[model samples]
Target: MAAYTGPGRDTLSDVLDWAVVRGGAPSVAVQVQDGDGTWFDAAGTADAATGEARAPGERLHLGGISQAYTAATVLSLEAEGRLSLDDTVERWLPGALAGNGYDGSRVTVRHLLSHTSGLFSTGMALEVQRRYGTRAAFREHRYDVWRREDVLRLAVSEPPAGAPGERFWYSTGGYAFAAAIVEAATGNSFESEVDRAVVRPLGLTHTFVRHRADPGYWGPHPRLHSKMFFRDGVRPEDVTPDNWPSLLEDPALPPLDTTKANTSWAWGAANVVAPLDELIVFMDALITGDLLPEAQHRAMWATESTKGAHWLAHTAYGLGVYELTLSDGRTLRGCTGASTGAHALVLGTPDGRRTLAAHVANDYSGFPVFDRLLEAEFGAPGFAYDR
Candidate 1:
């Protein structure tokens, strides 16, 4: 009922502080809900220059986690008889994936949601990486707007990762096609569909689409930071997890403030923003069948193997969500999201009786802080935090 006033809630603050003080995050916020009640806490500075403490209410970027919402919207359309998961991308958007060794006729809606479509990630293209992947490139194109067609074109121009349904290949470009299919089927923008199916229905006041023209958060939020900036001749691929710890401590590349960058390049894939508590409610409603019908809800967790996805250890990909096997071997479902300067994770039990939501205001991927936090909440030994 009160912030940090529930069972096992007392230690969350320490974990958050550890993330900031030791894990190289500028700020971290976390919220948990269970039979004991709800608890909230935050640590580190929201604005490093001002030494402002992080607040539990700050709106944080959801990043790729937004794909879950988009996927839910697609499922809602299916529930309404507007489309089917088996429907080929070609069925709705003719010739959208016909070029560059792609055959949309074989790429189904399910393939896109489960990351088995084998489509190349436009966001990971060399051109995009050179333009916006690193801190130096980000500064150059911070305000540039990338149209949907422009982004998708880069995907098809590259060779496919493999045949459709061959294996897990994470791709934001695939979600772009999914969003286009949504519009093609409903004759409405993907954002509008999400509002109708998830946002408005759940009364999520803090959550909304991050428009291309809007280059910053609408209200109070942490000043996002990243250590992705490196000296010239350093490639994005060189920033590996093995070196990330040292990089975080590297004096030459102190965290760069990336708070004001445009997110239009990730529109349908990673554009939602919400505070931790609202995100918890959204994820809970999703798995608990509050936002979906029985059949669709069942379909949400019908997971596909993530063997080659290089995702979290002991995990599998599902429709708009992930099936994570914890240290104790208990399965939980949720999504992890990241962008230039923010990261978030939301996971809950199938019954929706327990949930954990966390946000870090630095752009490091798959940090150990989340693993420690999950262990504290679930009474587990630990999770496989390795990337």
Candidate 2:
């Protein structure tokens, strides 16, 4: 009920200053915009061995922010009359997703965009990798696939969960199904569609489709560590590296790069990678109507978010964007991404009315530093800050 009335929320001036004072080495690159204007800061190290503090203009892989980009592209296609939000997935991918497990005919594009399709998570799909025993099998089977539908044939197995338009369940598999529809309707790879529809329109230079095994594009990503020890109130590494760590301890992560396929990325689900700056620019533009027509813009942002007790502050998802209400009563529309050791997030107030901050770190976020730094900048209630 109380707003953050912190002493100096106006200037997270103490944020980086404290790090410098404590001799704490926090290498971070942030592009922020208060109501006034934009500012860029890169004070973190890109690589310890290289002593590369994040440079002023370097490209880092933006994880799930790609979802927003996906939405923009889909809406752009709608403008071109190439697709319809009301259309059903069955219309696009006939034999692939018709009246069997789901009322694919009734499941419109809107459902997927709003995350209301009640689709199950994509963890089942990842299980298919087990079929390929040798590492070389993973390379040939996982990486070489171009069509998402083909992967769906092998990977996707989520029978419809809720009704056609019932409750909400966060699932990238649904988005990937949407991507399959886009491809079926347009006859082009989802990568090509996004490149033309969103990236080119916004002039996002550093963004690209991570459709293939391009380590150069992925850049440097740390191994992922998680909260295996949930009850310890301690980091998971303390409970001894979890199963994943044990699996990937030796050569570390088993080089998922052997194959060109980023199946984990799925279709329109996650196969996007961009620099942090480009992500902010894209979000700012999308919110300000630099991307969509007025009506389409309203449709995308105004979609209903039927979230429950989990994330009470705010829980809304559009074609690819999520609107999160921070503790300060300002809604920050953004997304979070995690893959192995790579993690990222981009959050900011609409139109840069007050503030914007993005974090991209190579390790898992349960380390507690993330939420701490986030609160330090975007304070919680009773902080007596400018908000």
Candidate 3:
């Protein structure tokens, strides 16, 4: 593990400066820490229509980043000897292996966290979801199961994309498979295991692995929200209320849906959601020796970074989180999230310096502004927004 002692700490006042300059109406919160002192700022509005500014410690989804937390719990269980990291699936869940090509035996814990476990398919954003933003909307209007077995079954019917560790691939389904492994090994659901191992110990009060509680609104056109994938923006459009391009051509060896005109499905890959502060605390725990024992923490970041859609300045992956070397040579281990009108980036040095930053809106304006906020806090010059 890299013990990073960050120098010349940045303050939250700098972040507020950038936010005041570039932030339009989107709500944003930023907190940056050094060894002794910390700086914090919350700006903009929480609700766009009402112009309600967000208070400190507001909630937002962490997206697939929760997988990193889930991965840690699985690894912890392995350390306790409840199950070996190399254990196979058939030994635990017998009949669950229906049509999926995933051999629980072949899919190791090492494979799951590092996204080496070649699961069935990369989940897709369905058409109904494209029209409706939130996962709740998907369930209300459409009948999508978004099950772990669905993709596992999809893989069971197919062949492995390649042998585990052959290359780098990002699949939430792989985490789903790993979650299943956790369930089979401990006889507890992934949600329960996470709540037990990670959330409770790390003291993440706002971290939620399950779905968000929806405010009841029966209008024909309700607000769309997605709890996964932050790409161009965290707009309702970015929520994949419809099919995304990457979801179409997955390596799961799809016997069907080879056609590009298919819909997206919810899977374990993109379900976890959380707030920015909780994410910051979780990252702090990973750095301060609350999450991993010590040796496991070292092992989690053992592999070298290869080609993937994303990587952090290219170090390695122990499990789910990416190891990124910052411009100042500090290792920032965390994830980026964009779902519906929400965006998240939780970053910190292994020593103690941490920053929890995020924005939530029903539009796309929040992203660039957040980037500019990061720039100001990180000592980068130039205002991000042209306006």
Candidate 4:
């Protein structure tokens, strides 16, 4: 609902147009807040099939950015004395993480939230999927469902990369374990807890945790596409209608249409959706301490080394959030996320004076436009990156 006005609107529009022209992202939705004014804009198509143009306020998957909400929910429960960051995974899930050289007894909730758990990632399973899970394979088993245990089992089927808290290693499986902790401690489903702690409290009516039976998007949501298989002698695919069961099946195939995929595989890791406007609001609230208590908020930004774990430079991992030190001295606090065909980046100044939340209907590689857009809005000095 925010409107871009004034002289800068033209610059912003130009940057967005350039994104579609050069970044290869078919669609992009962005919202920015500066002091008291907010701006929202969208460029390119929402659905290739319908030739629908992207619209402001349309929802898109938050991808790994959903980790921020999960972290906030856990921290809220901690504030309620229902859980503690130091609590070990074994304390809640018992022997849930016992095999493949993984020891849950030594992995604390903080470790999981901070990506220091060193547990095997679902990416370990993905190596197999990429080889055999092609588009045709996905069509055959698209609707298959996976339970939480199934996800945990797949993650641990391979040996852990490191010991708990020894170093930073991004792992969606760790967050899935954290979600299980939320359930065990709160006596509520992960979806309900996130709703109670983050979504409802923030009045984010457009956001929801997705499930197998749930349609991926609500009204007017953008259809997601990807260039995942371009390197494999295949063209870009519209992965907006099929389930992601191929993630667990054999003869791994190319990235299938994940738009309607059952997100149970992602669960606590990356299954949240909201429009750019709502995400901007969420980032503003998060950085300004509206989401968690002072201690937890501080903890969320207390980052550790993520060297070699992330693609971006000057990046560090915090509790479910990423601390990115811009070329300027200012630090942007929020997270970046990617699903099959959706990529999101939400960041805000510590004082909440400026916020930027942008989503592109493409994969992780389709993010240069966002960087350029950030530089356009925040000045070139704030977003100097290696390309």
Candidate 5:
């Protein structure tokens, strides 16, 4: 890894340039806001075949960052007195988690939001990986549709990971349950709830929650490419038009087209899509207490230690966001998302004065690139770039 430094050079541009050089992805899009001002930049080709440069406002799959919206909606429902965070899942949808030795009564809305519900993630099931996890399988069934109930059932059918709240376990299935609770309590679709609670209120015109049945809903966006590993080695593959599901199982497959895959399988957990700029706005609002009442907002940041979670290092899992403690003793509150060929990250101070939101048109392996960018952006004095 090389560090970029020179007279009159921009830090954001240099960081993105270094990411590309380090093979973070074939293309990257980023937005940053500080006391100085705001900036947006893109690098590499979005469509490898056509050699099109990545655009600034191109929409990309939000991945697990969608959890933030889902969590916020749940909190909003709690604020309205429609539900309580401590309410059991069975209280909202009876018998939804009765089988597979699972007890919804033992799980609460808070547990689901915090990923402490002990639910086994259907997204991590072996069968799911074989059927829709690889690039080849993704191409075979890019348009496969799934219902919320069916997906939830598949998740619960798996064995429980542990007792509810025993320890921290990141589970997409928990968020699925949380979304179902939202629908049941509000008597409206989860998508509709998100629109009313977050999108319309924020004037976010480009953000949307995609459903599995909507196959023809390809709006204007950049071509998504995957930095997939093949027998030959890692290479960039244009996965636009649909194939995100491929990376769900085995992310090491050869980069294949995932831009057109049905994302319903990731519904409620990782199905939202938005441009990088809107993502920053959303994060700012979220961290600034604009989305929830004062107490609820405070509760949202009450984080649980993820020391042994084997997921994120030196981090804490909040209601739906993550609080990452940098090596420099500074902390950032935001979320990061990855789905197949798309990866995104947004982090800022509690006051919302400084923020950074970035997206890479690649898969899981791009995370290290994001780590380096964060170090460059917020590293403390005497920090060394050890790569």
Candidate 6:
């Protein structure tokens, strides 16, 4: 629980300092666990206004990492024989994906979990883009609440990304639909289902879901910051692809404090929050087969190639997790979550012997540092930088 001065401690500190001093992050916190023990470290400020330092165990939005929890819940349901991975969307939520050229019967729970359902993301809808895509729109509508039905309707308003299982289209709408299916199959809220499946079983004291109406963190946490610049004279439409780089580098502007923004738009799919340490435990349990039955656990890590999916570099999509390949050609299982101003990642070896979890108070750009940090800790080259 003290400052890490073990192997690679200096290298980790250098990267952490770089992230805050030059990488534009307000703060960065990282925790790593292995056979020796657990180590935690932080750099930069937790609150920009207060100049408070970031610390380990500080709760932050889990972002896309919530998909792993949702995935676990659905798999547990399958383990109970209440549902099947191959169950069609229509089997549970009868006509939800029927419109927008989507055949609900053609999409299965597995497809949704693996981002292969081909459902167009509600977050990518033109209307959504016009309203919340840019910093200006975000500032203006940060507090707006979106209902579950509203998100579903927005999703089907667009055409399918591809036929089910044909392409890897990363869609939060897919997870939302999966959450809806979980509700129909269990007759319970997604949060309760996650609690039953992931939280309670793993004894995670700090992890919980963020409801649509809630726009704040539950306990002590760092202030989330984002680089979605919102200048006074500029409109959302004005920040185009060609000029965003220049705008991002303008040192005169401060990052936006998105800590208070409502995340209902991607609720259920990316709403879970927890401290970094608890996240490591949950991820390790999930990876080590402590949370699901043998067959289901195997299925959870049965990652397929994301050749055509909107995936990260050196990563492939699993049921609700990611299989990240390192430079050594070894792969690890993990998940990533991001809210407006925060980004989080949980990565571990397949056997769960070693794990690393990190949170950044800036946008996802802070992720590249993980590659170096991982190598420094685990003795393997990471994907972020070449040695």
* Candidate maximizing TM-score: 1
lDDT (Cα, tens digit) per residue for candidate 3, span 1-387? 112223432444555545545543234566555555455556655544566655555555445566677777877897788876676656666655434344565666677677776643343323333434333343454433445565455434445556666655556556656777787788877777888888888776766565312221111111222333223223433433133534332222211101011121333344554555567777777656677877777766676564442333344555766655545655666665544444566656667565545544423444565556555555433322111
| Ranking according to TM-score, highest score first | 1, 6, 4, 5, 2, 3
For 1-387, candidate 1 gives per-residue lDDT tens digits of: 365476556677778878877877878888888877778788888887899887766788888999999999999999999999999998998888888799999999999888889897556566676677556677889898978777667668678988999988788888888888888999987778888888998998888877667776677898888776545565655554345344333454667788887877776788888888889889999888899998998888888777645456778888889888866678888998888888889988878999999888877633577878877777644545435
Model 2 scores what on Cα lDDT?
A: 0.57
Comparison by lDDT, 1 against 5, better one? 1
lDDT of each: 0.80, 0.57, 0.53, 0.75, 0.76, 0.80
**Which residue ranges in model 1 land beyond 4 Å of their true spot?**
234-252, 380-387
Model 1, global lDDT: 0.80
* Candidate 4 accuracy as lDDT: 0.75
Give the per-residue lDDT of model 2 (tens digit) for 163-278: 76786655666777777777777898877888998889889887887664443354543222222112212222332212333332223232332212344445566677676667
List model 4 lDDT by residue over 17-97, tens digit each: 887887677778778888658887878888777889887778788889989999999999999999999999999998998
Q: Measured by C-alpha RMSD in angstroms, how accurate is candidate 2? A: 7.7
The local distance difference test score of model 3 is 0.53
Candidate 6 stretches with Cα past 4 Å from truth are 2-4, 229-252, 379-387
RMSD of each: 2.7, 7.7, 9.1, 5.5, 6.2, 3.1
Ranking by lDDT: 1, 6, 5, 4, 2, 3
TM-score list, all predictions: 0.92, 0.74, 0.70, 0.88, 0.88, 0.91
TM-score of model 6 relative to the true fold? 0.91
Query: What is the Cα-based TM-score of model 5?
Result: 0.88
Q: Candidate 3: misplaced stretches above 4 Å?
A: 1-25, 94-103, 124-148, 154-161, 211-273, 306-315, 360-371, 379-387
Alpha-carbon deviation at 327 in model 5, angstroms: 1.0
Span of ten consecutive residues with least summed lDDT in model 4: 234-243
Better of 1 and 3 by lDDT: 1
TM-score for model 3? 0.70
